[model samples]
Target: MSGPKEELGEQRDSTKKKKKKKKKTESGKKRREKQQEEEGVKGGGGGEEEEEEEGEKQQVEEEEVHSSDCIVLRGIFKLGKKSHDVLLTRTRLTWTPITPEMPTGEACVLQPGVMPLQDVFAVKVKRRRAAGQESGGPVLGVTLFCSRQRGRRLEEDTLHLHNASAEHTYTWYNTLKELVSGFSSRPKCLKVFINPSSHKKEAVHIYREHVAPLFKMADVSTDITVTEKKGHALSVMKECKLDEFDGVVCVGGDGSVAEVCHALVLRAQLDADSPEKPVKPVLPLGIIPAGSTNVVSCSVHGVRDPVTAALHIILGHQQQVDMCSFSSLGQLVCFGFSAMFGFGGQSLARAEKKRWMPSSQRREYALVKTLARLKPEYCHLSFIPVTKTTRDLFGHHSEDEDLDQDPGSVDAEGEGTWTTIKGLYLNISVMSIPCLSPHAPRGLAPNTSLANGSASLIAVGNTSRSEFIKHLKRYSSSSGQFSFSFVETHTVTAVRIRPRSQRSWSEEESEGEEGDSKTTPIIQTEGATFPWNIDGELVEIANEVLIRVHPRLITLYGEDMDEAESTVSCSCI
Candidate 1:
C-alpha cells in the first residue's frame, strides 16, 4: 500500500497532461480554418485578375489588326492651285504637307485635309515623257475630277497627282478607279425609248453616236425601242414589265418625254388601284434632249447638251420634278410642263396650220400671223394660293420629306381659298418648271422650282400690240419680261379657266313663209374653238380646263439647280 502524499502527486500529474493535450487540439483546428479562408479569397481574386488581363491583351491585339488592315498610299498631289502630300484611304483622300510647319508652344496644329470618296466623279491616268528622253523614263500622272464646294457654290474640280514611275501611277489609278466605281449606283440594265420624229429627227442618230457608247462603257445593258408611230412608246411603257428594268431613258423632245412620263405615272397609279398588289413607284426618267425644244432637259440640266445629259444618266445622278395634270370634264387631257391659252394658244394654232411648211418657216409665219391678229379674249380665271406656311416649310425640303408628310393632306378643290378674276386676257400661261429652253434661257417662269409643288400663273391682261411686243422683246433681252403693269404672276397649287363666250360657233336657220317650215344649217367656222398649247403641242379645248400640280411625281436625271445659278438669268438667248 502507498502513502497518502504519493497518491495525491500522481493524480495532479495526470490532470496536468490532459489539460495540455486539449489546448493543443483546439489550436490545430483554429490554424486549419484560417488557412482555408485565406485560400478561398486568393483563388477568387486571382481568377478575376487573370480574366481582366486577358481581355486587355485581346483588345490591344484587335486594335493592332485593325490598324494593319488599313492600306495606305502616299504621293504628291496638286489640287486646284495648291500642292500637298496626299494619303489615299478606303473612304477618303487626305492631304497634308510632307514637312508640316510646327506651331509654336500651345498653338493649334494644321488640320489634315480630307476629301470623301463620294465627291470624286472620275479618275484617269496619263503617262508623259521628258523632252528627248522618251525611251529611258516615263512620268505618270493620276487625275481626279471631283465635286468641290467653294463658299456657297458647288463646282467640279480636277486634281492631278504625279509619280516618277509608271508602276506607282498604275497602282494608284487602279485603286482610285475601283473606289470611284463603287460610288455609282447606276443601273445594270435600262429600257430605252427613242422618238424618231422629234426635233431635228436625229434622236436615233444621237443615241447611236453619243449616248450608246457611254452606256456601253458604263457596262449598262439597254433594251431599245424606236417609236414608229404616235403613242407607240406610251403603249410599250404601259404594257412592259417595269420591275425588270432599273430605269427608262427617253430620247426625244418634250412631247415624247411627256408621253413616257405620263405612261409611267398612269401605270403606277393603275397598279395602286388594284387590290391584289402593292403600289409601284415610277421609274426614273432620263431625257437625251433630241428635240426642237428640250425645255425639260434644259431646265433640269441647265443646258441642252446631249452628252451632259447622257453622263448624268450614266452616273446615276437624279433629281425630282413636279408634274402638271390638265383635265377637262373629268378626263385627263394631257400632262405638260407649261400650258398657255389666249394669244399663246393662237400662236400654236396658227403654227399647226402651217405644218406643211418647214419648221423654221412655219414658226416665223405663225408668229407674224398671230401677232397681226392679236386680240384679247374675255375669260374667267380662278386659282388657290399655296399657303405661305406650306411654301416656306416645304420649299427647300426634298421629295423624300414630302413623301414623309401626308401626301393626301393637300385639298385640290378650291374650298374657300379661290381667288377669281374676270377680264379680257391677252394670254394665260401656267408653268410648273422654269420651262428653260434654248430660246428661253431664263425660262418663262424663272422663279419656279422643279419640285416645289407649285406652278406660276402668268396672266397678261389686255394690252396694246406695241406694249405686248415690248414685253415679248424683253424675253430676248437681258432685262426680264414680267415687269409690266398689265402682267400679273402668282404661285398657285391649282387653276381653272373658263371662256366667257360660248357663241364661238353658230348655226344658220332659214324660215319659209309657206307653212311652218324651217331649215337649220350648221356653220363651219375656222376659228370656232379655243386652242390650248400643252407642253409644245396644240390642242383645241373649247370648254373649262383644270390644271393641278403633283409634287415630285417623277424623277429626272440631273443635279438640283443651284439657287444662284438658277436665278442668275442666263444670256443664252
Candidate 2:
C-alpha cells in the first residue's frame, strides 16, 4: 500500500531487526559450548552440585555390575613378594577401593607412575578357549603396579592401575582368558588347616618344625590351626570363609583327610548360592601324610615327602577323585580305604589295645595276642550286601547303575557257608597305592588308580591251625612273602559278616582237646550275636556287617616313589 521508496525503507528496517535476532542466537550457542567444556574438565572435582550429579551416573553403572558379581579376593599385599597366580573363570574385572563395599579386600588395581611395584609378585593371566578355537585361546601375562598415596591405607583409597611387565602381563592375560572360559578358578593365596592328632599326637609339631619351612620355600602362605579333638578339623572347615583360599591341605592320616572332604561337600550342599549348585564341592584339597598308614597320600602322589606336596600346592596341579561313606552300627563313618572285617579286623583291634605299651612291646603283644584269637573256638561270622536303592544315600558312584553294580557272581557263596577249622583269620586289605606292604613285593590292588571309582577286595580264608602258623612266619620275612595258596580276592559292592558260637575250653577242656584232631560240624543259619572286627578294631555286632569301597574322594601329596624301586639317591632334599 506504500510508495516504492517507502516500501524499500520498511524492508531494510525489517532486515536489520532479523540480523539483531540472529546475532543473539549465535551468542547463546557460544555460551552453552563454553559451559559444557568447563563442566567436562572439572567433572571429577567440581562443586557439590556437579559432584552429586556425576556420582549418580557412577552409581547406576556399579549397580549393574554388582547384580551379577561372582569373583572375590582377600589376602595380604606387600611390596617385593613373589607374584602368585590367580586362575579365574567367567568373571570380569571391576575396580573398587579397598572398603567394606568390596567383597574381596584387595587394595586396588595397581597403577603405573603411582608407586614402585618392583617387589609385588608377578602376575600371570590366561583365558579358556572359545567353541571354535578350543586349543589356542587367550593367554596374557601382567606385571601389576601399585599406585602412590602418601599415608593412605590400601584399604581406604581408590587406586589407579597399569599393566605389569611385558612377560608377566602376557602370561596373566593368557591365563585369565583360559580361566574365564573354563569351569574352575584358583586364587593366589590359600589357608591351610592341619590336623596334629592324626597318626600320633605329634602331627602339629612335625608339620610346623619340618613342613612349614618347605611351604614357605614354595611361596605358599598358610594359616595353620591344630585340631584339638576328633572332628575338630571338620568344624573349622565348615565355619571358615572358603572363597578366600585357593585350596586347603591336611597334614594327617586318611581319617583327617576324610573329615575335610566331608565338611567341604556338606557345606556346599547347604549354601544357597553355591557355584556348583546342587552338586558336590569342587574345591580342590591337598594332604600331607602324618599318619601311621597314609594310604591315601601314598596312593595319589606316590611319596611321603611333605616338601614335594607343598610344591604341588603352589603349582596348582589338580585331579578329580572319588569318595565313599558308609554306616556301621547305625553310625555314619567315612573311610579313604577299605573297612577290614576278618583277621584284618582282629589284628587292628589287638594293635590298638597294646598301643599304651612300649613300641616293641606293642608290636610283640599284638602279634602274639592276635595269634591266640585266630582259633575258631570262639566266634562265627557272615557277610551281607546292601541293596542298590539303599546304597544311593551315602554313595559316590556315577549315575549309571551298571558301573556301580556289584560285579561278583553269587554262585560261589552257597558252596562255602562255613569255614570250619581250628583257627579263623581275615584280612580286609584295601590298596590305593601300588605298594601296600613296604619292603615286600605284595600290593593290595596294583591295577587301580587313585581317582578310579572302585576298590579291590582281598581276603584271607584259611582255618587250619598249622597253615595259620606257617602263614604267620611269612610276615616276619620283611618281604611279606605270604603263602598265597589259601588267599582269595573278590570284587564285590559290599560284604556282610555274621559269626556263630565256637567251642572254648576252660584250660582243662583245652588240655583234653590238645591231642584231639576231630573236626567240628557246621551250625545252621540262625540268629546269633557275633564279634566283628573292622580294620583291626573289634566290636561285637548282630550276625551281619556291611562294607563298601570308595574309589577317589581326595588328593594326596607324598614322596615321588614309583611302583618299581629305582636306585635314585633318596634324600629329603
Candidate 3:
C-alpha cells in the first residue's frame, strides 16, 4: 500500500520477524533436548551406582554363606608326618602359612587347603608344663584323631596342637568335641564271641592283649562270650538279643565266623516269617583273625590283621557280602563261604581228624595224605548262569540296583535254564567269596564279587595224578591256577550237585588204598554218605545238595572293593 522504498523496508521487516520467530522456536527445541539429555545422563549414572551397590551386597551375602559363625583360631597343627599353620573354622579347618608378609585382609583372599569338621574323630587334651617352663604353668597340649587320606592311603591320623594357655587349649578341644560329636558317635555296645578252641587256641589271648584295650580306649562296652564247643557260638547267636548291641564280633577262624553268620541269617528268616514282626533286620558282623586260616577275616579286612578289623568296627565302616545257603533234600545243612566235594572234602576231613597234631603240621600232613589218595568222583553238577546286563559285561555293575532276593524260596529246580554237566571231577568247589587265605591268597574263586548275587563253580575234571597234584600246587602260586585244560569255571546263581553212586569210601579204606600204590582204587559200595566240607568244618551228608546265593544278606565291617572287576584272573602279589 506504500511507495517502492517503504514497501521494500516493510518486506525486510517482515522477513526479519519471520527469521526471529524461527530462531526462537529452534532455540526452544534445542533447550528442551539439552534438558532431556542431562536428565538421561543423571538417571543412567544413578542406575549404575545402584547396580554397583547391589553387586556389593550380593558378594557380602555369598561370603556370609561360605564363612561360619565360629571365631577363627590360628595355630600350628602337626598331623601325621607333616605340620602346617592352619585356621580353624566352625565347619572346616583350613591350612595356611603364617607369615609376617601376609596383609591383614589379604590373607583371607588366598585359597587354603581345607579339611571338613566331619572327618575329625576325637580330640585329647594334656595340660602340662612346657619343657623349660615351671611346673603347673600355662603350656597345654592337644591331640586330634581324624580320618585323613595322604596320597593313595586313607587312614586315621593323630594331629598334635600346642597352645600357650590351658583356657585356649580347652577351647580348641571343646570346639573339636562339639564338631565331631555332632556328626559321629562311637559304637556304644558290641556282642563279642571268642572261640576258645579256634586254631592255635589264641583267640582269647589276642583279644585280651590287642583288642580289649582298643575297645576300652574307644569307650565301647562289650558283652564277651567264650564258646565251649563247635556249635556253641551258633546257640549263643540264636538266643542273644540283637537289639541290645550295635554289632556282633567273631574272634576265630572262617568256621566260627560262618557259624555266627549262619545263626543270624536263620534267625532273621524265622523272624521274617513270624506274624508279630515280619521285619528281618540283619546285624552287621565283624571278624578278628585268630585261627589256622582266617579266610573270612582276610577277605573282609584285605589282611589278617585283628587291629585293623577292630579299627574298622570302631570307625563304623560297613560293606555287604553275599551269603551262600546249602540244603539237602529240603533239610538245611549249613551256611558257609565255600562248599567242596571230592578231593577237597576228603582233605578237609583228614585235616579234621588230625586236629590233635600241631596246627601247621596237621594241614600239610592232611594235604599230602589226601593228594596220595586222590581220585575223581563221578557226579552230576547243574547250575543256572547269572543274567548279565550290558553294564555288567563292561565291568560296571551298579551297587544301587535292588538284588536282594530270598535264595531259599527261589526255585532253581523249576525256574530257569540249568546247564548240566556229568563228569568225573577231582574237586568241585562252590565259593560265594574268593575264599582268600594264606594258602590261596588270590582266593580259590579269585574272580568272584562280594555282593554280586552270584557264586563261582570250579570243577576240575578227571586228570592224571601228577596233573592233579600240579593243579593243587597252583593254589600256592599267584598265576596259572585256572589255566589248566582240566579246570573249568562258571559264574552261577544257583547250583545243584547229585552223586550217581550213593557209595562213599571210609578214611581207613582210603588209607589202605593209598598204601597199595600199585593198584588203582575202586569205588566202594559200603557207605552211603560223602564227606562235605562246609567252610573248614566237615560234615557227612548224602552227596546230593542244593546251594543258592543270597545277595547282600549280611554286612561286614571293612573296606569295599572299589571296582567291579573280578580278581580271579589277576595275580594276588
lDDT of each: 0.71, 0.46, 0.71
Off by over 4 Å in 3: 1-84, 89-120, 129-139, 146-157, 182-186, 274-281, 387-414, 507-528, 561-573
Measured by TM-score, the strongest candidate is 3
Give per-model CA RMSD.
Answer: 18.7, 22.7, 16.7
lDDT measured at residue 84 in model 1 versus the true structure, 0 to 100: 68
In model 3, how many backbone clashes occur?
A: 2
- The 10 consecutive residues of candidate 1 with the worst lDDT sum are 505-514
Q: Which is better, 1 or 2, measured by TM-score? A: 1
How well is each residue in 82-128 modelled by candidate 3, as lDDT tens digits?
Answer: 45577787778777545454555454344567777655556778556
Of 2 and 3, the candidate ahead on TM-score is: 3
Question: Judged by TM-score relative to the true structure, which candidate is superior, 1 or 3?
Answer: 3
Error of 2 at 339 (Å): 1.7
Better of 1 and 2 by lDDT: 1
Of 2 and 3, which scores higher on lDDT? 3
Q: Which whole-number lDDT from 0 to 100 does residue 362 have in model 3?
A: 74
